[model samples]
Target: MTLRPIRLLAGAALSLALASCGTTYSMPGIADETNSRASTMFAEAKTAAPRSPISESAGVNRFARVARRIEPVARQLCETELAQGKAVDCDVKLELDREMQQRNAYFTYAEAGNRSPVIRFSVPLLQDTGNDDEVAFIMGHEYGHLIGRHIQKGQQQAIAGALILGVITAAASAQGGGYYDQTAVENSMELGAMVGQRAYSQTYELESDMLGTRISHAAGYDPVKGAQFFARDEAARSGGGQLSFWGTHPPDEKRMAMVLATMEQIQGQQALTRKASQ
Candidate 1:
C-alpha cells in the first residue's frame, strides 16, 4: 500500500517548524569538519586543474563583475526574508573556483564561527556560461537555496522519517509477537531517511527556480536567457532515459518548463508594478 500522500503532508507540516528555526554557529563539530573538508578540496582543485587563477583571467573578471552586481541585490532579498521571519539572517559569500571542470555551483551553510552562507562557482562554468544573465541566474538560484533553508529542511525531514519508521517497526513487531532484530530496525530507519530525502527534492528545485527567476529579474537580468541553459542541457541529455522515480531532482525538461513559467510570472508582476507607478 502507498503511504506517500499521508507522509508528504506530515513532512510538510514538520518542515514549517524545521525551516523556521535559526542556525547556531558556535562550536565545531561534524558540520564544521565537513565544511572545512570541502573548502580544502576546492583549494586543492585549484592547483590540480592547472588553469590561470580566476583573478588573472579576463573571462573570469567579466564573470566577477556580474557577480559583484548581483551579490548585494541577492543579499538584500535574503535580508528581507529574514526581516519577515522567513529565514535566519545569513551572510552571503560568492566565491569562484577555477579548478573544477564540471559546470556546477552549490550553496552551503557557513563554517563554524561564521554566519555567512557560501556559494561556489566552478571556473569552467564561469568560462563556458553563455552570458551575464546566466551567471546571475545561477548565483541567484544558489541564494534561493540558502534563504529557503532547503538543506536544513531536508536533514530534519530525514530524521523525522527515520524516527517514524523506527517507531512503526518496533510497534508492528510487538503487535505481531515477532522478532524485530536490530538489523531490521536499522534498515527500516535508513530506508525512511532515503525516502524523506527524495520527498521534497523536486519541490525544492522548482521553488528555487521560481525564486531565482524573481531574483535574477530584480537584479536586472533577463531570465529568459537564464533558462536557455536548461533547454540546452536537456537537448544534450536527449538519449538519457526518463528521470528515475527515486531521483533527487526533476528532469531537465521539467526544470526548463518551470523556468519559463516563473519568468512569465515575474514579468507580469513587473508590468503591474510599472502600471501602478504611473
Candidate 2:
C-alpha cells in the first residue's frame, strides 16, 4: 500500500521534470573566478553596531568556526554529484568582514585559476542571528550555491540573455538602415543581465534550502530551529507571518515549509533504514 503512493508521487514528479526540461539556454564565460575580494572588504568595511556590549568580535569568531566546519561537508556533498572516483581540487576559505558591510554570506570561486571556493560572512549577520543553528543553516545554504555551481549557471543565463537581446537590437537597426543607438544597446544588455540573474532564482533558493537542510542536520544542527530565523525576521519586518514572494528569493513561509518538509523526508528515510536493519 505504501509503495503504491510512493510510486504515484515519483511518477508525478518525473512528469513535471520532463515538462520543465523542454527549453534551455547556455551562458558564455568561465564559470568560476580566481579573484579574491576579501582584501578590499577587510580594508574598507566597518561594523554597524557598537562592539563592547555584544562582544561582536566573539560573535564573528564563532561565525567563522561554524562556516569552516560546514565547508568540508559541503564539498563532500558536491563530490557525491560527480562521477565515481572524481574529486574537487580545492579548499573552501572562510572569512568574515567585521565592518558589517552587509548582513549577508555568499560563496564564490577563487580567482587566479584556483577552484577553491570562498565563503564570507558579515559581522552584522553574526550579531543579528540568534544562534549557531541559524548561522549553520545560512552557511550551508551559501555552500550549496558553491557546490551546485549556481554562480556559473547564473552567469551563463546572463550571457545568453545578453546575446539574445543584442541580436534583436542589431536586427532592428539593420531593418532601419541606420546605426543602432549606443545607449539603446547598453540598456538592452543591462535589462538582459537583470533578467538573467533572476531567472529561476526562486527555484535555486529552494534547491539550496533542500541541500542546506541535509547539510545542517548532518553537521548536528537542528534545521527546525535554524528555520526559525526566517520566521523571526519576517515577524520583525512585516508584523505578522504574512506570506509574500520576493524577487530572487522565495517567501519566508514557503522556505520554512520546504525546510520542514525536507526534515520530514530525512526522518522518514532514516526510519526506513532502521527498520531494514532490524
Best by TM-score: 1
Report the lDDT tens digits of candidate 2 across residue range 98-206.
Answer: 6544455677766767667887776756665657898889888776676556776677667656555555565566567777677876787678667766676676777
What lDDT score is found at residue 77 in candidate 2? Answer: 78
Per-model TM against the reference? 0.72, 0.69
Candidate 2 ranges with C-alpha deviation above 4 Å: 1-54, 84-90, 112-115, 175-183, 234-251
Question: Could you give the C-alpha RMSD of every candidate to the true structure, in order shown?
Answer: 12.6, 14.7
Clashes of 2: 8
**What is residue 202's positional error in candidate 1, in angstroms?**
0.8
Q: Candidate 1: global Cα-lDDT?
A: 0.62
